[model samples]
Target chain A: MAQRIDVKDLDIYYGDFLAVEGVTMTIEPRSVTAFIGPSGCGKSTFLRTLNRMHEVIPGTRVEGSVEMEGVDLYGPGVDPVAVRRQIGMVFQRPNPFPTMSIEENVLAGVKLVNKRISKSDAADLVESSLRGSNLWEEVKDRLDKPGAGLSGGQQQRLCIARAIAIKPQVLLMDEPCSALDPISTLAIEDLIAELKQDYTIVIVTHNMQQAARVSDRTAFFNIAGTGKPGKLIEMDDTSTMFSSPTEKATEDYISGRFG
Target chain B: MSTTAPPTGKARSRSASGRAGDRGMNRIFRLVSTWSGALILATLAAVAIFLVLEAWPAISLGGEELGEQISWFPEDTSIITFVGPLIFGTLLAAFLALILATPLAVGVALFISHYAPRRLAQALGYLVDLLAAIPSVVYGLWGILAFAPIVYPVWNGIAETLGWFPLFEGPAADPPRVMATVAVVLAVMILPIITAVCREVFLQTPKLHEEAALALGATRWELVKTAVLPFARSGIISGAMLGLGRALGETMAVLMILSPGFLYSFAIFQAGQQQTIAANIAAQQPEAPPLGVSALIATGLALFVITMAVNMAARAVVARRKDFSGAN
Candidate 1:
């Protein structure tokens, strides 16, 4: 069974300025959860805190607990490296290691972390990971080509394959389809539905329709003004939230009345 | 209505004049910019041509005596003791300096870019900049009065402990300035320049690439080793070549630190047996006979060729780097 993520009373700060304040949410296991909001609304910050990736930035800190499968990710003894290994992340842009080949990029996590896998096992892993991401047929013949040579959509799928190669329990995608064309966006959305069967996935997107189409549950966040912390406006099942959100602010944002 | 029509025509004429004035100013700016660029290139070309012309006589004279048995002297008691110990010493010292300075420069660059706090890194950077501004004569004076004396005991200790090895054997009497000491001083003097250039290159690494490495569960050291080092490898090589050029042309510091002789010997510990070209030029150019002066110029020509080759190699590395970085 896969593990669920529970973020409790989370507050993120950049130096002395609070970016997100007192937000709490439970992300169900084996389901697709979406965070949608305007720019600078702290959706990305909340997502980064789930895997302790927020601490990588200088002067950035997070308060409160993000627990995964009963283990507190921010505990004193917890290694953020280990936490990130279990909870993989994809960024807004597709950043495959330019120096590595397509095949090498897919197997980077396994090769970098575990040194004992045999050549045959590694090959099998690369094939299965690429197939799972629906990129095997497109890139199978050119595995030795550099990852940077691929098109924008192909590179994003390559990053997806790289993330899944380690078989992480949770995958975080920050606007994975934002940089893709319409056709690529549909392909990624379809991949998300299939991926939910094996791993918990959380995505942050500014595209409200993407949230409505792909997520099992949606959380809408908004900021009051400049220098104010972002706050969660609503969280519910996908259909109810899109059709009839409980909060007036969520309805106003969804209807394009105001951001 | 007739009066208004004349006033409107006057306004149109005024706007036309303003547009013409702006166009004329733009043309003047463009011409000045183009001339400035051409002037800079012309100055560089002139300097290169002048050096070659001044050094031509020695080059031709040395070529004529290439097959001589002893290279005893040219015409009119002008000793043509060319292609001997000193040129070899200069190359060896520069090579040693490169070996010692490269790793330290890269390490300091990595520290400043990835590890140090902003204020502290800025302070350290200023300190390095100050090193480049310090006068070469002051460095020579410091080497003679302070560095040599302080480092003498350490050198002597190594010699005493490892005397059985050929490289560590002490000289017969007083320990004089040798190749090893000169190489060490050169390394110290070139360290700041190399580190500065390398730091700038390392800082230019894309932030997204670094974040991607971290998000893949790589430790900080692993991230640097896998991503940062590989990405900046060519830039670091270029920076090292730049440092080597400086070390090769350095004169006053090497002259003050080395007890240069005209004999060629491979032994590291022997004093007054090794000398570099730059130091030799400074020491002998004043009292040298005409051919001796030409021989020194010939040596200068050799140094010039070496520096040009290094710069060309550095340019090649820099040109290929963009392809490696996937920027093309």
Candidate 2:
């Protein structure tokens, strides 16, 4: 089941360098929330901290809290691995395990956890997940082929299938369509709209139009200057944020006047 | 150097030109590199020809010729039969060493490349490389003096506990200058070679793939299994093959550590029970008559063929898996 995420004064750091300053937001369950910002603005950094994926980099630290279903994800006893199991992530580039077949790539989340699934069960999950990502039709006939052989769009879709196969409560996508062509980007946007019905979705995008089209809520992040930590500027309903933002900076950013 | 070149205007006007000097240097480089590559094949062919020509007498020797005592060719057998025990010993010793070293080498490699802290990893990598730099003669000395005594009790324990197994069936060597000790020494000798290559490959695993595995809720070991190991599989095979090549042809360590013998027994802990082809050739060459030298060369040729076959097999394995590794 999808769960609401409540962030309370969260700060992110890479060693001694603070990357994202104190900020707060509540992400609703079963809704599309978009994070929009220019490069190095810490929108992606903040997104990574949600599932604790940023901790993969050495010396990265998180302060304050990210809570889901009233449980603090950054609580002392929480395992990052377990946190990740509940919150799946997709990266800017599609990475379907190069050594695996299309079907096996879709099953990577479960298989990597060492779960035992019957042949029929594995087939069903692969089929359903691929269909969910809208990749089943193009790939079903060649499920045994290597995943790396696919086009960029198909590979990204395959990665989406992999993430959803684990059935996480929330999904974080870091520029999922940034590397795709416009047609492929539209397909992913449609998939996002459908995915939000069952899973809480958080996306980071450079394309403002993408956020406007797919997201129910939009959060804009901005950096004050070089070497300054990025801060959350504003967040509001998609229509309201696009049309009449309370902050001058948010309006400037949306209107292409400044970042 | 600049003064020797053509005028700048002429040099620049030539459509395909970089610098006149560079074009000339490139031509020389191509010529030298081509010759260097050709030299390798020429030397290999020369070695093969020399072996066959010198080994001709031993190849043609019959039982009657052996009785004539033209030269000692294993007393009663021809060169083909004489090489049987040597071939067996070479394969067994190298096989045992590979078994002993590959997992340990891969473990140490994984630790250096992934598990160790940054500074410690660099230090450990250098330490392993330093081991490879130690000469085979020094390893031979260490094998007989330090390493052999250290493993003597363990060898005896194996003979006592697992003596029912053919490989362990032994009244262990008195001074322990045996095939089993020699195999251990060879394993240590080859460990750094495999570790160096494996560490390089493991370090080269794509960051994207590793992050994918990590984001999938994979543990450290699981990530290694799913991402790092698969990508490094071909590299590991090639590394192991290189180590095996060294073990197979290693003469100094085997000669100094193993007491030369002419038996086909699998009992490796017994002294004077086995001898590798290279070691046998080295050991018998000095004492043998002229024909005996020919017989040794024949065995050397055998070693060469075996090493070549092993390398070819490794290449085939690597090539077969190339499609799925995304290395293409």
How well does each candidate superpose onto the true structure, as a TM-score?
A: 0.88, 0.94
The sequence of per-residue lDDT tens digits that candidate 2 reaches over residues A1-259 is 8999999999999999999998799999999999998789999999999999999889999899999988999998999999999999999988888899999998999896657898999999999999999999999899999998888888899999999999999999999998899988988999999999899999999999999999999999999999999999999999999999999999999999986
Candidate 2: stretches off by over 4 Å: B1-29, B66-72
- DockQ of candidate 2 is 0.44
In model 2, how large is the Cα lDDT of residue A193? 94
> For model 1, what share of native contacts is present?
0.62
Off by more than 4 A, model 1: B1-41, B62-81, B156-176, B263-266, B320-322
TM-score for chain A in each prediction: 0.98, 0.98
Which candidate achieves the best DockQ against the true structure?
2
- Candidate 1 per-residue lDDT over residues B284-309, each given as its tens digit: 78877665666677678778777888
Tell me the tens digit of each residue's lDDT in model 1 across A133-182: 89999999989888888887888889999999988999999999988899
The alpha-carbon deviation from the true structure for residue B231 of candidate 2, after best TM-score superposition, in angstroms, is 0.8
